[model samples]
Target chain A: MKHYREPSIEAAETGKPSRKGLVFLAGLTLLFSSCRLDMHDQPKYESYEASEFFADGQASRIPPEGTIPQGGLRQGELLYTGKMDGGDSELFPFPITQDTLVRGQDRYNIYCSPCHDKVGTGRGIIVRRGMKQPPSFHIARLREAPPGYFFDVMTNGFGAMFSYSSRVQPRDRWAIAAYIRALQLSQNASYGDVSEEDLEKLEEAATE
Target chain B: MAQLFHPNINILIRILVGVVVVLAAGLGLAYYQGYYSVYFSQVNVFREQPVMFSHKHHVNGLGIDCRYCHTSVEVSSSAGIPPTHTCMGCHSQVWTEAPILEPVRESYRTGTPLQWVRVHDLPDFVYFNHSIHVKKGVGCTTCHGQVDQMPLMMQVNTLFMGWCLECHRNPEDYVRPREEVFSVSWVPPSNQKELGRRLVEEYQIKSRTNCSSCHR
Candidate 1:
């Protein structure tokens, strides 16, 4: 019978490895490439204890009610009456400039048109689908209302409407009100029409 | 007789093994530290401010309210940073000499706002309402930490999504009286569960367990 001789170290090291080395390599590959074992997996709590709501140490220092410290109108005027007596003095207070009307129209289409309709007719999809119906802008009371009044209704919200104060800023709400006024006027123009010269100018502009 | 191994081949193997080990270690360190910057590169980490603005000084010391500076917090999506004019209201006379007050004065003169770094930041996707939380008796300190004590405020709690979910899931377990909104002092409830039950019954507080309450 022929005797088998052990391979020399030089022969063993010549190529990759023996069968045992290949098995070890495969095992290491599996071990290192395994799914991650995360240690900080425990869920973090918001740390809001019930005691936080109670008058505890520094937590008890509650701010006063309705304390808007910045450039807003006082609550009674800005929120209720829509007057900007104490609002930012530098900015134009809600009578609606020519540019504001254009901006207001754009904003109205984006926000109010979905619920109030483009024509201010109150027949929006939400209304048509049997949700709460908004009052038409064509009504005499709303048509005659000041721009500030409309702004107030938009901010603090009127009956059956939740406050848009969260969604719309003070200035944007005023802009929408301005646009609503424009819509009201357009639909209700009366016998006191444009002068002949003005009409001619408008006609000439249209031709151009 | 021994066969000679190439010196370059041995060096190449050693270099390859070293590179693999280093790459593995780096990946492991990043995973361990919760370094998810790669995934959320767009997320702006809430930053700490340079100067210490004291809520305690204004709100507690001078009897000013949170609304004075954060006027829009209750009514708008953002708490709204106070313009320089708001700070000039009192600082105009109060702390004219303080070195830290110089930045504030400059901002007012230039009609610029102080770049007060925000500390409490929720994820962009989550919708949190300050007015609803304030009105519902959730205290500012519940999320803001001890702002009165913080010299230069840092985020005390991890404002993670799970953190918000926990309180929102169990509001009564966390809700307290509206008046105690700012106090850090804890006075144990005589009846904990009873208070929770009462709030649930009286306030008609629909379960915050609903996903849409905070998620939407």
Candidate 2:
């Protein structure tokens, strides 16, 4: 009120009305402006929104059959199905690298570790919560199983576990199979399996 | 006419004017606060979804990964919402008889999608890509909060322009190791300043405050 000098103190003396009420009214109007949300939410569909116009009631749609998205041509029978010449191939379709193993480890932790456990043991958090326990990767049968067998099981699913093909990509699936090999070695290996250089480091650590 | 009024009334009028001014100022403050409150912004307010999926039970209790259901978070713009089949993946085997999961089972059987109410819906004009944020080492919990702790999904950040600008302007304050992006209980270490700065540099995150960066 002090900031606004009377629009006319002389007018006040002459009995003219003040404009101060208009300023207060404008402030009130501005306050209500925040409530308007015409732009906050628009007429367009957001992801996974139910569509009234669509017959399926979904804003997203399933692609027609035989439609292949980019990089989705299911070529390389060994890579896609873990089989070649009508049998589960015992070799990886692509050469495995350190980066592939790292990526596999990451994906495995996210998609498989829930049921297979971080150590690839039968006990995971889900098993404790009542889901069926998966077989350990350390078992004799699984240890003797080819890398292709592991990839096949993940793509098609085993007895109790669901197929992860839709969740994990093909490259990552191969990568997880590779990581499972490394994990098996980690669990079943002895001191003799270590390299001389690494064994020396292990001995140093053991002494410490 | 009797001096138009009692001279003492002038003091009374002045006091009333002061009261009116103070009252108006208080009202303005309340209006501003109210505009940003949970009622208006929906921050920290949980909306009831159809099935009432609990992230706490799935994430913390069962150790399910965020990517277990939202599989495309790293590869696509929008984080994929799991179809009912994803829910049935486990529920069909474990919680097969639970009344709480009847809607999920029904959706799976009937092939009708469950209407899940979106929790972190941004304005239509703003373009947000989950993949870019994930690739740039912005942890899921950075914007979404610690979802493992939420029994019901809710908005944690205000999702306002000012709130986004905080990270966009200085990503070093929020960036984490790419490996830790999906981790539920990952806390910023004491050396977050150093680590985040390195990650921001390593991830090549640009300080994108241009209107075109978000608004198309």
Best by lDDT: 2
TM-score of each: 0.43, 0.86
The digit string of per-residue lDDT tens for model 1 on B1-216 reads: 776777688898999999999988987787655543423322333345655676656444443445545666666666666656556544554466789888888877875445555456565446677877766767777777665655455566566666777776777777777667645553438775678667767766665666676665
Which residue pairs overlap in candidate 2's backbone?
Answer: none
How good is the docking of model 1, as DockQ?
A: 0.02
Model 2 residue B37 distance off true place after TM-score fit, in angstroms: 0.6
How many Å off is the CA of B182 in candidate 2? 1.9
Displacement of residue A58 (Cα, Å) in model 2 is 0.6
**lDDT of model 2 at residue A77?**
85
lDDT of 2 by residue, B92-116 (tens): 7887999988999999899998888
Candidate 2, CAPRI quality class derived from DockQ? medium
| Cα shift from native, residue B146, model 2 (Å) | 2.1
DockQ winner: 2
TM-score computed on alpha carbons, candidate 1: 0.43
